[model samples]
Target: MRTFIFLCLLFEEFHVRFLVLTTMSTISLATEYRDVRASEILKQIENGEDVNLTDCRIIGELNLSEIEVETVPNPKYSELLESGFFDGEDLKRYGVNKDLKVVESNIKIRNSIFENDLDFSNALFNKSLFFVEGNFTSTVNFLCTTFGDFASFIGATFGDSSYFLNTTFKSISLYGIDFEEMWVRWDSLENSLVFDGLTYVKLVRNFRNLEQFEEADAAYYQYRKLRQAEKSWILFQKEWPWISFPKCGDIFMWLTCGYGVKPFRAFGFGGLIVLSFSFFYRGWPAISLRSEEKIDRICRLLPERLQRFIPTIDWPNPGISRLEPNKHTQKVSFWDAFYFSMVTFATIGYGDWYPKDKFRKWVMIEGFLGWLTLGLFLVTLTNVTIRP
Candidate 1:
């Protein structure tokens, strides 16, 4: 009996020790978890010291107004808000500065009221910056700010006009800035979105112009196109409830050219067709159809060098050596003429191409148009190709 009692005592003592160790470990883990909160870091900042939030995931809503975070020095925070740190009211008022540097932060300010006048003038970001689904109830200025990495502002709702004048983005993802549903005006300046300081390593992708202003202008144009498409579709739907062909055409054109539509080859082919038709036909005459006067008018529009290429029926020699008139002048429709014109301008001399005696002047006109069109296309292509 004494032996059995001794064994029971030993087991009880071991169980108690295990319970004490487990309790201590739980307490330690809780303490460590609390240490990672933004509240704790804000306290350090409030004490006028620099806090490195590097590789730290903050939890809960961060309210800068409540926490005394001032005079933060060289904070090495990276990949912040990766574990879902919610934003509080007027969040930008707390951390904004004239020369602040934020790198690789996935900050989401979903449904939060941002009333603070966030000023990031001359700020620099060396990594990905995101502002997804946030509501900015006040002005946010990024004047002269430099984004040295990928930047995104998708699904964000701005209360007022956001100023990005003179801001330079190294690489931007702006797929959602269309003004179809959103009513927002962009703040414009004389020299906004300049990309003069960009290096070859930090060039933008897809966009040709490295300048920030040019990119902004492109974005604005895209927005305008989307809005116009939306308006046209709405009018079409209202006017013709039974038929939707026109609306479908508008959508097809918009998808092909306006924004992020697919099958780029189709768009290119359509453009080529339009160009060809315009070239083949002399275009619709405003009034009477005096062929000679029309021909003279068209020739006058041709460039000086091309005017010399005009085939003269008065002489037997094919007036110009390299250039020729359209052979199917009688059979070609407006669209066909347009496509032919594009082909000629592109200098893609297909074998079946020739100019009839009646349309001899048009050959010179087409050649001139082709030269000018090709020159413009080359310039744009060069700008896009040169990354730096």
Candidate 2:
């Protein structure tokens, strides 16, 4: 009976060992099947097949190498994100790698929901990168990525800072991306970039166009205010000459009004003739016959030496002639004076008039002053009219 009990115990032990071996084999086979399934899924993704991970309940962290993900028929990016199957940790391990290739992917997230943060920093894209008409309910990071071709984010919305610092793109477009009050950084190392009508503050302030970099709002306000202030300062300088020359206000008024600077300058040099005649002839004829000859008689009474010194003095018929003997007796109108002064200063002789000796030389100096004043006026006018 004891021998029979020992054999039964030995048989029971053997059966227990056999059951353990079978269970282990079954577990091993199941594990191999899971691995094979995972590999098949990866192959399908690489072959540009549509993948729907929406119904997947348990998604473990996946680590992959040298894999490719292609969007076959332009699946919604947000739908994939909301499928509750893509864990951030899994993406960090399997999706974010320089060796991994993503080609011709049309990633759209049209008003879909998301429950986690998406980070694609330092990822290399070798083909067309599209995020057209998508909505990101969380922060999206695309820092330091090298886009080998066209990168588009047209009509995408971001809930936080859309950081793209040190990112390189051959061509980019962010036609409509609302970032409420976030800052966008798109610093690049190349040129030939364009940004048409991008309403971002940081973009407007830093870059000249939108084809290369993304946009932001805070930078826009800063640039706008700076440009406005510059315009205001230019206007003030044009309108208020006193601001430039406080004590010279009366001098400028005399040049403009009393000397007939405006009208003379506008006449295109017919005014110069009038001024020459006024300086030489002095005044017009009077009604009285004896009074008409009075200036002549007075001029003749002067010494011959004085007459020689002052050639403008016409001793023979000083009353009728433009040249009179006495300087005080010569009365020149403002318009005539300004014209003569401009011609003498510019040294452009009309030949219809002449200046008498040293007196003419003195008048030439006054002409120089007139030319300078007119030039300044024109410069100020241009500044006011055509601002930078």
Question: Which lDDT values do the candidates have, in the order given?
Answer: 0.44, 0.45
Local error of candidate 2 at 132, Å?
A: 1.9
State the lDDT of candidate 2 residue by residue for 128-237, as single tens digits.
65555545566666654556777766666676555665466677776665654333343352241333345344355344333222232224433333333344222255
Model 1 lDDT tens row, 1-388: 9999999999999999999999999987752221255466446534544444322334433443444322222221221223245242222343433334433333333323344454444455554555544445566666555667666655455665555644666655443332112211233212222222121112222123324434443554444454555554334454564545566655544444433322243436456654544533534321112243433454456577853564432222221122224531233223234434655556675534455566657656656655644454455455444535
Reference-based TM-score of each model: 0.32, 0.31
Error of 1 at 35 (Å): 18
The alpha-carbon deviation from the true structure for residue 314 of candidate 1, after best TM-score superposition, in angstroms, is: 9.9
